[model samples]
Target: MTTLTGTERKNITPGLSVSIVLKKDQRSGKLTDGVVKDILTKAPNHTHGIKVRLQTGEIGRVKVIKTGIV
Candidate 1:
C-alpha cells in the first residue's frame, strides 16, 4: 500500500454537496457543484481525488466540499 501526497482526494460523504472536476473539464479547471449521489471510491484513500457521482448524474473527482450557499 502507498499513501498519496499532494492534491490527494478530499474527504467526502454521501449527500454532501461538493465541487468536482470532470475528465472533460479538467483542462479548463472548471468546477461543477452538486450533491453527492454516490461515492465511487471504496479504498481508504486515493491520490487523484475521490471519484463520485453527483445528483445531476455527472461523474468526477471531488475538488472542493461545498458547505455554504453558492
Candidate 2:
C-alpha cells in the first residue's frame, strides 16, 4: 500500500515488474528483478511482503516494484 516493502499480494498483479528476494537469498537480502507472472500467497496479507513467481520462473517475496526493470 503506502510502503513498497510491505506491498500486499492483492496489489501485486501479473505482468508488473518487481524486485524480490528468494528463499535461499533471504539471509543475504539479495534482490532479483523480474516481472510478476503468478501470485503464490493466498492469504489476505503478509508482513514480510507477498510471495510471487516472476516471468523468469523465480519465486520469492517482493521487496521492490520495479520501473523499467526486467
Candidate 3:
C-alpha cells in the first residue's frame, strides 16, 4: 500500500483517516490515528505537517494520510 505524507494542507480533509504526532509525542515520533474533525493549519503547507483536530478531540500535526479508506 502506498502512503501519503501530511505536509500539505490541501491533502487533508475532515472525516479522512490520518495519523498525527501530538506536541508531546514529537520527540518520541509517536503517531495517533483517527478521523479528521478539523483542519487547523492556515497555510497552504507546513514543513513539519498540517495541524489538525481528530474526531476524538486530539489535536496534532498530521504525519500520515491514510488512503483507500474513509
Candidate 4:
C-alpha cells in the first residue's frame, strides 16, 4: 500500500501585508479604502494602493494602512 498526504495550501492570515488599489474620482485623485485578499503580483517600491480582494468577495484596489502611510 502507498501512503498519501493532503495537498499543501497557502495560508492567508487576518492581518497579512498586502497591497490594494485606489479608486480614482473624476475630479479628485485621492486614494480609497479597500480589502486585501490575494496579491496579484509583487508591487513595486513606488507603487501604492494596488488591487485587492475584500471579505465581501468584491475585488478592487484600495489604500491599505501601512507603516509610513496612515
Candidate 5:
C-alpha cells in the first residue's frame, strides 16, 4: 500500500467552516461521511486540523483530505 505524502494543500484560514471525508482506514478502507466542526490555527503548520470543544464536548481533528474536497 502507498501512503499519501500530501498534495498542494491550499491555505484554509481559521473560522471558515469546511467539511472533509476520511480517505483511509486501516481496517475499513475509507470513510465517506464527515463534517467540519471548527478550524484550527495554532499548529505550526498553520493548517486546519484541530479539535475544538463543542456543546457536546466532543474532541476530534478535522478529517479533511485535500483531495476529498475538490
Candidate 6:
C-alpha cells in the first residue's frame, strides 16, 4: 500500500480515496477524506495540490492519496 503525496495529477483518478483540504479548512490545515468523483485540476501538477471533487460533492485540493482503497 504505497500512498502518493497527492500533489501530482497523474497520481489521482476517479474512485480513488483521498484526503483533501477544503478552501474553508485551508487555514486550519484540516483534511477531509472521500472517494474522488472528478479531477478538477487541469495542470499536471500544482504547488498547493491537485483539486478534485469528491463523491459527496465536496471540492478541495488533495493532500494525501489513499492507495489500496476505493
Top-TM-score candidate index: 3
lDDT (tens digit, per residue) of candidate 5 on 1-69: 222221112444333333332323424534332333444335544233443322233343444433334
What TM-score would every model get versus the actual structure? 0.76, 0.82, 0.94, 0.35, 0.27, 0.92
lDDT of 2 by residue, 2-56 (tens): 3355367767789987889999999999999888999999987888889999998
Q: Predicted candidate 5: what Cα RMSD to the true structure?
A: 7.7
Stretches of candidate 5 off by over 4 Å are: 1-41, 44-48, 65-70
Q: What TM-score, to 2 decimals, does candidate 2 have?
A: 0.82
Clashes of each: 0, 0, 0, 7, 0, 0
In model 3, how many backbone clashes occur? 0
- The C-alpha RMSD in Å for every predicted model, in order, reads 6.9, 3.9, 1.9, 13.7, 7.7, 2.2
Instruction: Point out the worst 10-residue segment of candidate 5 by lDDT.
Output: 1-10
Rank candidates by TM-score, best first. Answer: 3, 6, 2, 1, 4, 5
Tens digits of per-residue lDDT for model 6, 1-70:
6678888999999999999999999999999999999999999999899999999999999999988744
lDDT of 4 at 15: 47
Q: Where's the lowest-lDDT run of ten residues in candidate 1?
A: 1-10
Q: If both were scored by TM-score, which would come out higher, candidate 5 or candidate 6?
A: 6
RMSD of candidate 1 to the true fold?
A: 6.9
State each model's CA lDDT, in order.
Answer: 0.74, 0.82, 0.95, 0.38, 0.35, 0.94
What lDDT would candidate 4 get against the real structure?
A: 0.38
Q: Model 4, poorest ten-residue lDDT window? A: 3-12
Better of 3 and 5 by TM-score: 3
Candidate 1's TM-score reads 0.76
